[model samples]
Target chain A: MEALVASAVAVMTAVGVYLILRRQTFPVVLGMAMLSYAVNVFLFATGRLVVNMPPVLSDTATGYTDPLPQALVLTAIVISFAMTAVVVLLALGSFIASGNDGIDLGEDRE
Target chain B: MNHWIIAPVVLPALLAPLLVLLARNDLRAQRMLSGAGTVGFAVLAAVLLVQASAGGIGVYRLGDWPAPFGIVLVADRLATLMLALTAALALAVLVHVISTGWDARGRHFHALYQFQLMGLAGAFLTGDAFNLFVFFEVLLIASYGLMIHGGGRARLRAGVQYVVMNLAGSVLFLFALGTIYAVTGTLNMADLALKAAAVPAAEAGLLRVGGVLLLMVFAIKAALVPLQFWLPATYASAPGPVAALFAILTKVGVYAILRMVTLVFGAGSPAGDIAGALLLPAAGVTLMLGMIGVLGARDLGRMAAFAVIGSVGTLMLGVAIFTPAATGAALFYLIHSTLVAGAMFLVADLVRGQRGGLLLAPGPRMANHGMLAALFFVVAIGVAGMPPLPGFLGKLLILDAARSAPTAWAIWAAILVGSLLAVAGLARAGAAIFWATNDDASPVPSQPLALAGVAGLLVALAALTVAAGPVSGWLNATAEALYAPAPYIAAVLGGGAP
Candidate 1:
C-alpha cells in the first residue's frame, strides 16, 4: 500500500512539474490540482502510513493512528481546495481579459 | 473569557454564512459586514495588545485538548504583536475600502475580505506548523478574488502569475512538512522544536535538508529575490485595498521564518546550523538585486513593490547574522516594513485613482491633490528609511547589531548601500509624480472621509516613530523572550521533554 501511494506521488509530481514549467495557464492549473492531491497524500503518509485505524478514538480499537497527521492533512485538504478554486478563477479571469493564460503577460509594462 | 479566544476567527466565520444568506437580498448586509469586520479588527487588536502588555502568551485548545494533540494557538508576545499589527492594518484598509466607495465592494467582496482577515489572524495566532498552511490558502483564495475584482485585463493576467507562484510554494511547503513529520512524527511547532533539537548527529544532514526546503518555500512568498518577480507585477496591478491587505501576507511569511528559526530550528540543530549559513549570502544578494529592480522600475506601484523586496532583504540581513541584538533588529524591521509597505501601496492606489492611470505614464494628468501628494511623499519617505521614521530606526538597529559580526564590515556596507538605493529610487519616483507637473493635470481631491482616514494613518505611523524609544524597549524584551527558548519551551511542553 505504501509503495503504491509512493509511485502515485512520483508520477503526479513529475507531471505537475512538467505542467508548471509550461507557459500556458490551464495546464498549470491542472498540474496544481494534481500536485496538491499528491502533496496531501504525501503529507498524510509522513505521519507514517497506517491501515484500518482512524485518528478518532473508538474505545474498541486497541490504539489509534497518529492524530497529528490526520489533523494536518484535513486542514491541508481544505486549503488546497481553496487554492485550486482561486487558481481556476484566476485562469478564467485571465482568459476573459487577455485571451491568453501564458505564464506572464510578457513583462506587464502596461 | 474564552469567548474572546475565538472572536477573531468567529466573527469572520459567521460573516461568510450571513453573507451567503444575504447574497441576493440586501446590499446593506454586505456594507454591514464591512463595518462588522472593522469592529472585529478593533477587538482583535485590543486583545492582542492587552495580552502582550501583560507579558502573557495564551494558548487555546479546541475541544479542550492540550497541544501536540489538539490544534493549539500560542499567542506569544511576538504572535500577539503581529496579530495587533495585522488587525490595525486590516482595519485601516477596511475603512479605506468602505469610505472610498469603489464599485468592487459588492456581495462577494466583503465576505472574501472577512475571510482573508480570518486567515491572516489565524496565521498570526496558530502555533502549529500544519495549520499555518491552511491559513495561507485561505488568504490566497480571497486574495485572488480581490486582485481581479474589477475584471481588468492586466490585473487578471498578473493575478494568474501570482496564483501560480504561490501554488508552487504551497506545494513545496507541504512536501517539506511531510518530510519533517516523517522524520520526527511531530506537526506541532513546539513539539517539533524540542524533537528537532534532539535529533542525533548521524541523521543531522538528512534533517537539515528538510529544514532548508521549508525555508525555501517561505522565502518565495516573502518575495526574496529570484523568487520575487511575481510580486511587483501582481501587487502593482492589484486593487487598492487588496494590495494593502497583501502587505501583511509576505510579512506573515517573514514571521514564519522568525517563528521557525528562533524556536523550532535554533542553534545546535542541524537545520539551524545549515540555514544560518545559507541565509546570510541570500540576504546580501537579495538586497542588491532588489535595489537594482527599484532603480530600473518605471511604474510607481511596481517600484514600491521592489522597495518592499529590499526591505525584506534588510530584515533578513540582521537575522542571517543571528545574534540576539541582530534578531531583535530583524523583528523591529519586520514590524516597520509591514506598516511602510502598506502605506506605500495605499499611496499608489491614491495616486492611480487621482491620475486615472499609472504615475509614470507619459503626459498623464496627475489628479492627486497637493496635500495628497505630500502625504504620499511622507509615506514614501518612511519606506525610504528617512530619519525619525520607524523604517530608519529599524535599519539603525539592524546596522548597529550587524556591525559586531565577523562579517560586520561587509554587512554594514551592504546595509548602507541598500538604504541609499532605496532613498534614490523613491526620490526619483517622487520627483516624477509630484514635482514634474504633468502636461495634463487632474488633481482630484479625495473624498473627505477617505482623506481623513489617510491623514489619520499617516499621523499614527509618525506617532509610532516618535514613540520609538519605548516601543524599542518593549520589542527588545519580546525579542529576548523569543531568543531565550526556555520560557517558550517551558510554556508549551511543561518542561518535561528533555
Candidate 2:
C-alpha cells in the first residue's frame, strides 16, 4: 500500500512539473492543481498508511491510525482550492488585458 | 497563558471580516474602523513588547489543551518585536493610503489590508508549523488582491507571476512539512525541538532533506538570487502603499528562517549546517545580483525593488553566520531596512505623482522639487548605508559581527562593494530626477498628507537612530533568547527553566 501511494505521488509530481514548465497560463494552472494534489497525498501518507484502523483513541482498541495527517490534508485541500480559484481569475484577467496567456511579459519576451 | 499574546492575531482577524460585512460600501466608516483596529493593534504590540522586555515567554494554548496537542501562540522577545514593527508599519502605510486616497481605487481595500495584517501577525506568533503555512496563504492571497488593487495591465501581469511563483513555493512548503512530520511525528515547534535531538541516526538524511527544502521555500520568499526573478516586476508594479506594506513580507521569510533554524534545528545539527552552507553563498550572490539590477534599472520604482532584494541579501548574510552578535545585528538591520524600503517606495510614488511617471529620463522639474530632492537625498543616504543614519549603524553592526566568520573577508567585500554600487545607483537616480534639465515647465502638485506619511516614516528612522543604544540592547537580548531556545521550549511545554 505504501509503495502504491509513493508511486502515485511520484507520477503526479512528474506530470505536474512537466506541465508547469510549459509557457501558457492554462497549462501552468492545471500543473499547479496537479502539484497540489500530489502534495496533499504526500501529506496524507505521512501517517504511514494504516488500514482498517480508527483514528480515534479508546480504552479497548488494538491500534488506531494517526489522525493528524488527515486533518492537515483537509486543510491543505481547502487552501489549494482557494489558491487555484485565485490563479484562474488572475489568468483570466491577464488574458483579457493583454490578449495573450503566455507566462512571459509581452515586451520582455522579445 | 497570557491572553494578550493572541491579541495581535485576533484583533485584525475580527476587524477584517467586520469591515467586509458591515462597512463594505462605506469607505469612510471602513477607514475609521481599520484605523481604530490598527491603533489598537499598535497599543497591544507596545504592551507586548514591554511585557516581553521584562524577560519571560508567554504561551497561549487554544481551548485549554496542552502544548503539543493544541494550537498555540508563543510570544517571546522576537515575536513581540516583529509584531511591534508590523503594527507600526501598518499604521504608517494606512495614513499614506488614506491621505493619498489609494484605498478608493478598489473595493475591499481596507478589508484586505486588515486581513494581510492578521496573516502577518499570525505567521509571526504561531507555534505550529501547519498554522504557519495557513497564515502564509492568508497573507499571500490578500497580497494578490492588494498587488493588483488599482488594476492596470502591468499590475495584472506582475500579479499573475507573483501568484504563480508563490503557489509553487507553497507546494514546496507542504512537501517540507510532510517530510518533517513523517520523521518527527509532531509539528509543534517546541515539541519538534525536543524530538529533533532524539531522531535516530538512520532518519537524519530525511531530516536534512526536509530542512533544505524548508530553507528553499524561505529563500524564495526572501527573493534570494536565482529565485528572485518575480520580485522586481511585482514590487515595481504594485501600488505604492501596497508595496510599502510588502516591505514586511520578505522579512516574514527571514523571520521564519531565524525562528525555525535556531529553535528546531540549531548548531551541531547536520540540517543547521547544511542550511547555513546554502544560505551564505546564495546570499552573497543575491547581494551582487541585486546591486547589478539596481545599476541596470531604468526607473526609480524598479531600482527600489532591486534595493529591497539587496537588503534581504544583507539580512540573510547575517542569518547565515548564525551567531548571537550577528543575529542581533541582523535584527537591527531588519527593522531599519523595512522602514527605509517602505519610505523609498513611497518616495517613488511621490516622484511618480509629481513628474507624471517614475522613468529615469530627464523631465520638467517637480513642483516641490527642492523638498522632494532633500527627502530623496536623506532616504538615499540612509538606504546606501551612509553616516549619521540607522542604516549605517545597522550595516556597521553586521560588518563588525561578521569579522569572526570563516568567510569574513568575502562577506565583507560583497557588502562593502554592494553598498558602494547602491550609493552610485541612488546618486544617478537622484541626479536624473532632480538635477537634469528638460523643456517642460509645469510642476506636479504635491499632496500634504501623503508627504506627512513619508515624513512620519523618516521620523521613525530618526527615532531608531536616536534610540540605538536601548534598541541594540533589546536586540542583543532577543538574540540571546533565540540562541538559548531551551527557555522557549520549556515555556511552550509548561515544564522546566522558563
Candidate 3:
C-alpha cells in the first residue's frame, strides 16, 4: 500500500512538472491541478500508512491512525481546489483578452 | 488567552463581507466603512503593539483547545510591529484609492482590501505553520483580485503569471510542511521548535531539506534572486494603490523568515544555520541585480519595483547576519523600507497620472510640476539612502550592525554600490519626467487629495526618522527577545521552558 501510494505520487509529480514547463496556459493549469493532487496524497501519507484503524481514541480500537494528517489533507485539498479554480479563471480571462495563452508575455508593456 | 490577539484577524474578516453585502453599489458607504474600519484597525494594532511591548507573548488558542493541539495566534513584538506597519500603509492606500476613485474601476475593491488586511494580520499572528499557509492563500487570492482591479490585457496577463507562480510556491510550501510534519510529528511552531532541537542526526538531513524548502518558499515571496522574475511584471502592471499596498506583501516574506529563523530553528536546532549561511550570499547578489534592474528600467513602475527588490535585499542582509543587534537594525530598516517603497509607488502613480503615462521620457510641464518634482526628489532621496531621511539612517544602522560579520566588507560594498546605482536610476527618471519637459503639450491638473496621500506616506517616513531613537530601542528589545526564545516557547506551550 505504501509503495503504491508513493509511486503514484512520484509519477503524478513528474508529469505535473513536465506539463507545468509547457508554453500554454491550459497545460500549466492542468499541471497545477496534477501537482495539487500529488501534494494531497503526499500530505495524507505524512502520518504514515495505517489501515482499518480508528482515527479517534476508542476503547475497543486495537490501534489508531494519525488523525492530524487527515485534517491537514482536507485543508490542502480545499485550498488547492480554490487555487486551481482561480488560476483557470485567470487563464481564461487572459486568453480571451489577449487571444493567446502563452505563459510568457515577453517584456514589460509600455 | 488575551482576546485582543485575535481581533486583528477577526475585525477584517467580518468587515469584508459586510462591505460586499451592505455597501455593494454605494461607493460613499463603502469608503466610509472601509476608511473607518481601517482607522479602527490601526488603533487595534497600536493597542496590540502596546500590549506586546509590555513583554508578554499573548497566545490565543482556537476553540479553547490546548497548545500544540489546536491552532494558535501568537502576537509577539515582531508580529505587532508588522501589523502596525500594514495598518498604516493600508490607511494611506485607501485614502489614495478613494481620492483618485481607483476603486470604482473594478468591483468589490473595498471587500478585497479588507480581506487582504485580514490575511496579513492573520499571517503575522498565527503560530501554527499550516495556519500560516492558509493566511498566505487568503492574502494571495485577495491580491489577485486587487492586482487586476482596473483590468487590462497586460494586467490580466501579468495576473495570470503571478497566480500560477504563487500556486507553485504554495505547492512547495505544502511539500515542506509535509516533510517537517513527517519528521517532527507536530505542526505547531513551538512544538516544532522543541522537536527540531531534538531530531536524531540521521533524520537531520531531512529536516534540513524541509528548512531549505521553506526558505525557498519565503524567498519566492521576498523576491530573492533567481526567483525574482515575476515581481517586475506583476508590480508594474498592478493598479497604483494596490501596488502601494503590496509593499507590505514582500515584507510579509521577510517577517516569515525572521520568525522561522528565530523561533523554529534557533540556537541548537538542526536547521539553525541554514538561513544565515544561504541568505547572505543570495541577498548580496539580489541587491546588486535589483539595483542594476533599476538602472535599466525605462518606466517608473518597473523602476519602483526593482527598487523594492533592492530594499528587500538590504533588509535581508541585516537579517542574514543572525545577531540581535543586526536583527534590531534590520527591523528598523524593515519599517523604513516598507513606508518608503509604498511612497515611491504612490509617487509613480501620480507621475503616471499627470504626465499621461509612467514612461520616463520628456513630457509637457505638468500642473504643480514644481511640487510634484519636489515630491519626487524627496522619494528619490529616500530610496537612494541619502542623508536626512530614514532610509539613510536605516542603511547606516544595518552597515554598523553588520561590521562584525566575517563578510562585512562584501556587505558594505554591495550596499554602497547598490545605493549609487539606485541614485543614478532615480536621478535619471526624475530628470526625464520633471526637467526635460515639452511646452507643446497641455498641463494636466494634479489631484490634491491624491498628492496628499503621497505626502501622508512621506510624513509617516518622517515620523519614523524622528522617532528612530525610541523605535530602535524598542526593536532592539524585540531582537533580544527573539534571540532568547525560551519565554516565547514557554508562553505558547503553557508552562516551563522546553
Candidate 4:
C-alpha cells in the first residue's frame, strides 16, 4: 500500500512538471492542478498510511492513526482548490484579452 | 496574552470584508475606511513594538490551547519589527494610491489591499509552519488581484506567468512541509526545533531534503538566482502603488529564512543551518545578475524591478552569515531596502505619469522636473549604496559584520560591483528622463499632491538614517533573542522539555 501511494505521487508529480514546462496557459494550469493533487495525497500519507484506525487517541482503542496530517491535508485541499480556481480564471482572462494562450511576454518570444 | 498580539492580523481581516461588503460601490467610503484602518494598524504595530521591546516573548494561544497542539500568534522582537515595517509601508502605499486616484482604476482595490496586509501580518506572526503556508497563499492570491488591477494585455500575461510560477513554488512548499511532518511529527516551529535538533542519524537525510526544499521555496520568493525570472516582468507590469507595496514581499522570504535558520535549524539541528551554505554564493550571483539587468533595462519600471532583486541579493548575504551581528545588520538593510525600493517604484510611476509612459526616451519636459530629478537622484544613491543615505550605512554594517566569514572578499566584491552597475543604470535613466527632454512639447503638469507619498517615504528613510544608532541597537537585541530560541520555546510551550 505504501509503495503504491508513493508511486502514485511520483507519477503525478512527473506528469505535472512535464506539462507545466509547456508554453501554453491551459497546460500550465492543468499541470498546477495535477501537482496540487499529488501534494494533497502526499500530505495525507505523512501519517504513515494507516487504515481502519481511529484518528483520535482513546483508552479503549488498540491504537490510533495520527490525525494532524488529516487536518493538514484538509486545509491544503481547500487552499489548492481556491488557488486552482483563481489560476483558471486568470488563464481565461489572459486568453480572452490577448487572443493567445502563450504564457511568455511578447518581446523575447520567437 | 496581550490581545494586541493578534490585533495587527484581526484589524485587517475585519476591515477588508467590511470594505468589500459595505463600501463596494463607494470609492470615497472605501478610501476613508482603508485609510483609517491603516492608520489604526500603524498605531497598533507601534504599540506591539513597544510591548515586544520590553524584552519578553508574547504568545497568544488560540482557544486557550497549548503549544504544538493549536495555533499560536507570537509577538517577538523580530515579528513585531516586521509588523511595524508592514504598517509603515502600507500607509505610504495607501497615500500614493488614494492621492493619485490609482485605486479608482480598478474594482476592489481597497478590499484587496486590506487582505494583502492581513496576509502579511499573519505570516509574520504565526508560529506554525503550515499556518505560514496558508498566509502565503492569502497574500499571493490577493497580490494576483492587485497585479492586474489596471489590466492591459501585457500585464495580464505577466500576471499569468507570475501566478503559475508561484503555484509551483507553493507545491514545493507543501511537499517540504509534508516531508518534515512525516519525519518530525510536528509543524509547530518551536516543537520542530526540538525534534529537528534531536533527530536520529537514520532520519537525517529526509530531514535535510525537506530543509533544502523549503529553502528553495524561499529562494524563489526572495528572487535568488535561477528562480528570479518572474520578478522583473511582474513588478514592471503591476500598478505603481501595488509594486511599491510589494517591496515587502521579498523581505518575507528573508524573514522566514532567518527564523528557520536561527530557531528551527540552528547548530544543533540535524539539518544545521542548511540555508547557510547555499545562500552566500546564490546571493552573490543574484546581486550581479540583478544589477546587470538594471543596467540593461529600457524602462524605469523594469529598472526599479531589477533594483529590488539586487537589494534582496544583498539582504540574503547578510542572512547567510548567521551571526547575531550579521543578522542585526541584515535587519537594518531590510528596513532601508524596503523603503528605498518603494520610493524607486513611486518615482518611476510619477515619471511615467508626467512623460506619458515608463519608457526611457526623452519626451516633454515634465512639470517640476527639478523636483522629480532630485527624488530620483536620492533613490538612485540609495539603490547604489552611495554615501549619505541609509543604504550606504546598511551595506557598511553588513560588510563589517562579514569580516570574519571565509568568503568575505567575494561578498564585498559582488556588492561593490553591483552598486557600480546600479548607479550607472540609474544615472543613465535619470538623464534620459529628466535631463534629456524635447523642448517643443509643453511641460506636463503633475499634481503636487502625488509627490506627497514619495516625499513621505523619503522622509522615513532619512529618519531611519538619523536614528541608525538606536535602531541598530534594537535590532541587535532582536538578533540576540533570535539566536537564543530557548526563551521563545519556553514562552510558547509553557516551559517544558520535549
- Top-lDDT candidate index: 3
DockQ of 2: 0.65
Docking class of 1: medium
Give TM-scores of the second chain, every candidate: 0.94, 0.98, 0.98, 0.98
lDDT of 4 by residue, B1-498 (tens): 567788888898999999999999999999999999999999999998998899878888877788999888899999999999999988988998998899999899999999999999999999999999999999999999999998878888899999999999999999999999999999999999898988998999999999999989989988999899999999999999899999999999999989887877776788765777888899999999999988999999999999999999999999899999999999999999999999999988888788778888888888888898999999899888887889999999999999999999998999889999998998999888888888865366778999988888989999998999999999999998899898998899883332
- Specify the CAPRI tier of model 3: high
Top DockQ model: 3
Evaluation by lDDT, superior candidate among 1 and 4: 4
- Across residues B151-190, which tens digit of lDDT does each residue of candidate 1 receive? 6788778878888888899899989888888877777888
Off by over 4 Å in 3: B441-443, B495-498
What C-alpha lDDT do the candidate models reach, one value each?
A: 0.77, 0.90, 0.91, 0.91
DockQ of 3: 0.81
What value of lDDT does candidate 3 attain over all alpha carbons?
0.91
Q: What does candidate 3's lDDT look like per residue over B33-75, in tens digits?
A: 9999999899999999999999879888888788899898998
Query: Which one wins by DockQ: 2 or 4?
Result: 4
Candidate 4: the clashing residue pairs are none
DockQ for all models: 0.73, 0.65, 0.81, 0.69
- Looking at model 3, residue B105 earns an lDDT score of 91
Which residue pairs collide, candidate 3? none
lDDT of model 2, residue B11: 93
Error of 1 at B66 (Å): 1.7
**lDDT (C-alpha) at residue B264 in model 1:** 72
